[model samples]
Target: MIKVYGITTCGSVKKALSFFKAKVIPYSFVDLKTTQISEETLEEWLSKQPLLRLFNTKGTKFKTLNLSKELSDEAKKEWLLKEQLLFKRPIVECEDGALLVGFDEELYLRTFSS
Candidate 1:
């Protein structure tokens, strides 16, 4: 089963959920606001996706923190743990163990259409 992690208010998350529904793909949504993501899960996702890819530098959260300046990988990791909203919406962990950071129709089709 695919596991989707993001907040409910995010448009990207909604789009991802809609795409899954339209394709009849089985998925479980994990709302970040309600259920906190564990460090273990963060480590697992980081293993598959680069720390840069997982980090959302353009989001409001990042803007609020003003993290655009050069920062070490450890700093970024700490920020990610401190602000989950700084993560790109709808991080999808596919049944095949593929980690996708955002919603791209073509990529989704290619990954899940089998």
Candidate 2:
């Protein structure tokens, strides 16, 4: 089963969930707001994709927190651990060990199309 991690209220997360439902895809949701993501899991995601891709620098959380774009990768990672909202929305962990960060319609079509 695919594991989707994100807050339910996020627009991109909603879009991703809707896309999955509309396509009859089975997925389990992990609400970041209520659940804590393990360091091991974060490290696993980092291994699959660049930290910048997994992090949300343009989100409201970023702006509200007044985070600097010039922050080091390590600093960003630490921030992510402290604040789950710092993560990009709709992070999908696929059955085959593939990771998808955020919602891209074209990418989703190409990736999940049967």
Candidate 3:
């Protein structure tokens, strides 16, 4: 099953969920506000995508924390593990085990339309 991770208030997350609903693709939503992500899950995402990709540098949480690019990978990971809002919205676990971060309509069409 496809599982999406993000808070309901996130626009990107809303877009992703809407895409799935419009496509008639089945998916489970995991609200980041309620769910806790584990180290193993973060490690798995990092295995598929880069640490920078998983990190949300543009979000309010990042700006609020005043994170810098100089932060080490370990430091970033620690922040992500502690702060769920720092995750890029709508992290989708695709059926094939690929992790999709954020929302792009073209990419969504290509990935899910198949």
- Top-TM-score candidate index: 2
Provide the lowest-lDDT 10-residue window in model 2: 33-42
Pairs that collide, model 1: none
Better of 1 and 3 by lDDT: 3
Model 3 worst lDDT run, 10 consecutive residues: 105-114
Candidates in descending TM-score order: 2, 3, 1
lDDT of 1 by residue, 1-114 (tens): 999999988988999999999999989999877777778888999999998899888788888887764788888888788788978888999888989998898999899886
**Reference-based lDDT, each prediction:** 0.88, 0.94, 0.92
Clashes per candidate (backbone, < 3 Å): 0, 0, 0
- For model 2, the stretches where C-alpha displacement exceeds 4 angstroms are none
Clashes of 2: 0
Query: So what's the TM-score on candidate 2?
Result: 0.97
User: In order, what is each prediction's RMSD in angstroms?
Assistant: 1.2, 0.7, 0.9
Compare candidates 1 and 2 on lDDT and give the better one: 2
Q: What TM-score do all the candidates reach, one by one?
A: 0.93, 0.97, 0.96
For candidate 1, the per-residue lDDT at 21 reads 98
Give the TM-score comparing model 3 with the true structure, all chains together: 0.96
